[model samples]
Target: MPSDTLNQFLNDNLNELKEQGLYNEIDVVEGANGPRIQIDGRDLVNLSSNNYLGLATDERLKEVAKDAVDSHGVGAGAVRTINGTLDLHVQLENKIAEFKGTEAAIAYQSGFNCNMAAISAVMDKNDAILSDALNHASIIDGCRLSKAKIIPFEHSDMDDLRQKAKEAKESGQYNKIMIITDGVFSMDGDVAKLPEIVEIAKEFDLITYVDDAHGSGVLGKGAGTVKHFGLQNEIDFQMGTLSKAIGVVGGYVAGKQNLIDWLKVRSRPFLFSTSLTPADVSATTKAIDLLMESTELQDRMWENGDYLKKGLKELGFDIGNSETPITPCIIGDEKTTQQFSKRLNEEGVYAKSIVFPTVPKGTGRVRNMPTAAHTKEMLDEALTIYEKVGKEMNII
Candidate 1:
């Protein structure tokens, strides 16, 4: 007594994925995702966490969470439009604005929700969005939800973007046009050409948007990509995740006062969804404060990235073109990449394989995330394992 259509579709999709060797099996981390992680009852050098700044387990952030829990209980009572906008929310937003060099800021429950809320709130069917081809899935969905004509410019292709923006303006295909891109490409770790992007935007009078989820805690001495390029005022939307480098949970948008004002009233997620809990909000504030305080974590993260990339490249393995700390050990076949990950797991390293759908087919790679928490000892051990596995798999 099964629903025939639903069951058939699910089974068909599952079978297809399995046949294509793309069916992913999930792994369990027994405890905290630290630099050294316990996976399936073994200690492994973890190189797959976005906890780049190691603030996820920082003592100061923990204390802030404890204090908030004691003072504000657990959850915000209701949605922001209802009874949920606590004084802490206002305080956190203010700190974020100051840190991001913006007139105002607003937080969302998650980074994905930030895109969902911000895009549709400002633009609609009458408008159009010029988005980068490799923009995050959240951004793509946000554009779709807005009912806007999504014009995907080539990835980091300035000439292509300029041509497309010019054509869109001339055709009068839609209303407002905004260009959105990730400040740093997460998988490849290459930075977006924001200076060129901004110049194009000014020429076309297009609104500039950058989702600096990966760049905030790493670039511009922790001020983020907009500040790195000295275009903080030129960009219209500065969206980011508190979860990544901030090492907390949530997202935000920093921009002009009027833009923030409009979003506060119009953004569906901000208005309808309940706000982040007191603990999360307060810890995030502490994270921003910490980043402003010192460059220790950012510096350590770069050291580790360079160390790992150098070691891997010396082993004669292809480490793709990466401008940031993200390191990918390129393995051309999906099944082989997964097998290599499995073999590395046996050798006490926990870098994960990224395959088709995340990247183009035949470009499968084992993506590594070297964080501030990783020590030279840990990285050396991981490098030793990578060398062994690369040779065993004939990948070097």
Candidate 2:
């Protein structure tokens, strides 16, 4: 049995969440999360996964992963600082550096962990972090863990960032200042105004960091947003994930040799946690090699994105200002948005509703992720269902 105090706290919080309509009931996908997913034995047109390039279920990656497991086993045995650093891990890091156009790179268990490790490794009590208002939760937690003064600028507002940066620098209170933002804002699919942000960083002598989790496999011909703007040398930290686009499970921080050296020594997760398995390392290396070899998958992903966007627009759905493949059909009220998603699932589509806290209140939306693996037939079916449901809900 749980402790009385803990039980009571959990119950109260859960009840409050339910009453506020904020409880999220997770769905169980029975098979691989691909262009089509199975739930309760029913296959649905999958538009909810972050498998942007469809490499998660790629045969080549699977073959390499299996071969690695046979050669190196399933686990890295100890913490990275101890005996866990394998040859495959070193090779993977080198591949990441080459892929991102950085001098050196370091990998973490997850993108969230990378943020936690990298932020606290450098910035601390005497520092300040000027973060975007709508940055990912991991970024928020990372900044807090640094024990630094955090000032949030309005989302994608360059003027606000510039003003905040100026104020923070002129105050002379912090020993160091950093500006952090997502390379691609996941919720709205908007690209960050990195050029302007870089200009501000230069003016204030601020350290620049961009979390390219969503942009790594989808932008700049699969190189990412830093490369998209040709500002590879300007950004201090280029953080990315292997999970979403690479169809694997890990994250990385790529930068100069000095920064990578600092992180290797100071990053808590790198020092304390076990390194990635040999299979993950080898498969990730293969994924990077594939990305470097061709732009076929990235190009297909964009084409699919454009096709879906045009279909949704023609069906009279409002997809907010998105610059990437992520599509969000705005449906103001939380309950209605939830109902719309429910109907979509019933009609054989798998898009999910995102509401309050994940997004602003009263701006609930159904987020759609179109991957390179999705067929035109699958998209056509999804659009047909969407049109039917929209009209039925009087949304279109």
What lDDT does each candidate get? Answer: 0.93, 0.95
Distance from true location, Cα of 9 in model 2, Å: 2.7
User: Model 1, 319-361: lDDT tens per residue?
Assistant: 9899999998889899998899989999999988888888889
Model 1 weakest lDDT span, ten residues long: 17-26
lDDT of 2 by residue, 1-396 (tens): 779999999999999977776778899999898999999999999999999999999999999999999999999999888889988999999999999999999999999999999999999999999999999999999999999999999999999999999999999999999999999999999999999999999999999999999999999889999999999999999999999999999999999999999999999999999989988888899999999999999999999999999999999999999999999999988889999999999999999999989999999999999999999999999999999999999999
What's the lDDT of the predicted structure labeled candidate 2?
0.95
How far is each candidate from the true structure, as Cα RMSD in Å? 0.9, 0.9
Task: Return the TM-score for candidate 1, rounded to 2 decimals.
Answer: 0.98
* Model 1: CA > 4 A from native: none
